[model samples]
Target: MQVSSWRKAAITASFLTLAASTANAAAGPLDPTQGGAGGRIIRVTTLAKDGPGSLKEAVEAKGPRVVVFEVGGNIDLGRDVLTIAEPYLTIAGQTAPSPGITIIRGGIDLKGHDVILSHIRVMTGADGKPHFSDWEADAFSSVAAHHVLVEHCSFLWALDENMSASGPRFTGKTLAEWRANTSHDVVFRDNLAAEGLAFSSHPKGEHSKGSLIHDNATNITFYRNVFAHNVERSPLVKGGAQVLMVNNLIYDPGHRAVHYNLMNLEWTGHPYVTGEITAVGNVMRGGNSTDADLPFLTIGGDGDLKYYGQDNRAVDRFGKALPMFGRYGETKARILQQKAPLRSVTGIPVLPSGEVETSVLQTAGARPWDRAPDDIRVLFFVAEGRGEIIDDEHQVGNGYPKAAETRASFNPAAWNLDTMTPRSGRYPGDQTGPQEKLSPRDAAMRQGGV
Candidate 1:
């Protein structure tokens, strides 16, 4: 009775919160400005090298920096991984000459505190070229990092997962080490993670993953993003405390949209800890192929897991709500469907159900910096097959910037193609890299300017 009463009260409060605002509520971790260097701006200049104005150099630079781009191009990292070990950094990919700035071949690792990554595109194996390591890394990964934000980016064709938040494996370590390895206060928002892969170390048979929040990662919020075309682990919720997935658009994933589990059972070696996920105002559409009828959420492992969902919608291709089911019988399903656990989340923004679809579509990935506002509004519909694709790439003063481009198209027809093999014609958008013109400002920025 008390739980029912609590759920009713919380539902009322959530509706009231939603009614109070009809705006696109900003999501994700607080900006990197919450701490460090009082927020300084560092402009990125290089495309092919790792020196001054280069993203690699920016990662190695000390202190908090709002790392902006003055050029747009791909950085070909043969097998090198960019590691950010400093505190208080913000990679402002939005400040580039265009939204198509900074496509990376090798992946990035966020192993620091108070970091924000935005507006960049990460293509793990560019142009279907293999990495020297046989494509064994994610586009973006974190370990024990705190107060991080990843937004307005696109990650595709990763050798492993597209994006992941995790820490070290527990090898029967002490409590201090365990505590030290836990990731907390992380948020992934307004991004696109598509066509993630499964490779060595990731379960091979039935689990190619998208985003993973591994065991011991905590306080994560996934808000208003697109998770499309992955087999499993579309933001898998492993053992953690306080995870919130809200207002996300998951379209056509090959398996369950969200999995609550100890993902890698062999590696975790656990007296498994309980994991919690609170889902709200989210949407999922089953794939057009064999995965069309999969469950939206699944509970795996025997851990004491908790799922509290409210005001969520799942649809098929025809816009019909899909059946929501629990793996266990009625009693377990009732607990998973309740809304009481999310009442404790106060002060965070609550998104209304109506706003989620448009918000996610219009702002999910990189957009042109100077395109008309109206065009930007309609771009998602065009990308989903309404109008013709626009050409925005341009030549700087005399010549084009020398960055690699994916130049791929969005092909929903290829959703069922086996991504495991090395065929380039799989997903929508650029399969190799982004194909946008370098901003004219790139010339000024590249000449030791800006």
Candidate 2:
């Protein structure tokens, strides 16, 4: 029996109502309550046009320190990776003059424990042409890190995964070392990860991804983030512990949506048992003509990868639920009701997936006070591949040439921007629905001045 889109909508509507009520009952900032608070404030006072202070030294400083920025601007790491190995650290870009700080041309590697990073922007910038060594770079990577919270950040134009939480990668590391490097208790919330990503380090450039969670990364949560303009892995979860992907907004994902897999020899080079993922209250929508007609779920390997889909929503241009897709003949009517084992991880918040678009639009990327008109312009330009018109004034990062680079022929900026214009208000992009209810920290910041 064929299912009508309207019937799917009705089921989704009921689920959304329930989820919304649950979210409404709970209200607070999703802060990393355990680390870096009440720590020593290490103020980064310089906008170092090129070297220390704002660039590398402060970011790489060791120990339980709160790294706060005094100035707001760009820091280009030039092919260098800023490795944060210190535990109990708080990198607060919100403390900058305008919370508009951006890290460009390089990536941030979190190899520490109990770290909290908020209101920061990490971009490879527009000039990251795909090289065979692209895999060496990523916007943000967590390696065996624990109790980390990455919130209200912007990650763009990554040659590899935009924001990834992976175990020890294969780089001549011993198997025991790889097993020892396990990431756990990480949370990525209210962030924007967008645009022009490469598949792997190789020149394929075919599979642009937003975020990837690889083997042994356990108990990770992605909540209320905007995964925009990338292809696959707007999280692809491989073998891991429990993963909760809740209330995320995927706008114009080019190839596919959330995928889960167990690892075999192809990628991990080892046989491994997979973990379970509960994808709830997420929304995926097509925003451009270039967006592909892709599956909502892709399962690979035979590693017991289980998925529990509840209250998720997908819409085409006309705002209808997408046709469902799963392996074999297990085709369901609505993609939202896919069945697998249902479980929960403690400390993971269950916000309504219905509010994902609104919540992300309100809080993702850099804080509103820090962004200038030029910053907004750059975001639009890079996402759409309109690199030719972008100049130094509009560029936020320090990558050379400062022009948008796209692997795809067709650009979608002109069309997507026309449909959605960001405005100065309580939300990020034009107030799409009821003013998003702000978290306590967000409300305090906005009331204090923006």
Instruction: Give the number of the best model, judged by lDDT.
Output: 2
Candidate 1, after superposition: displacement of residue 354 in Å?
4.2
Q: What does the lDDT come to for candidate 1?
A: 0.57
Over 40-109, each residue of candidate 1 has an lDDT whose tens digit, in order, gives: 5566776755877678888778875556565655677765678888987767554454325645456888
Clashing pairs in 2: 281-353, 387-404
In angstroms, give how far residue 115 of model 1 lies from its true place: 0.9
Assess each prediction's global lDDT (C-alpha) against the native. 0.57, 0.58
Instruction: For candidate 2, give the lDDT.
Output: 0.58
CA displacement after TM-score superposition, residue 353 of candidate 1 (Å): 2.9
Per-residue lDDT for 36-118 in model 2, tens only? 55555566656553446563566566666666555666666766678888787767665454335677777888888888777
What's the CA error at residue 335 for candidate 2, in Å?
Answer: 12
Candidate 2: where is the Cα deviation over 4 Å? Answer: 1-33, 49-52, 126-136, 169-180, 198-204, 266-271, 289-292, 327-351, 372-450
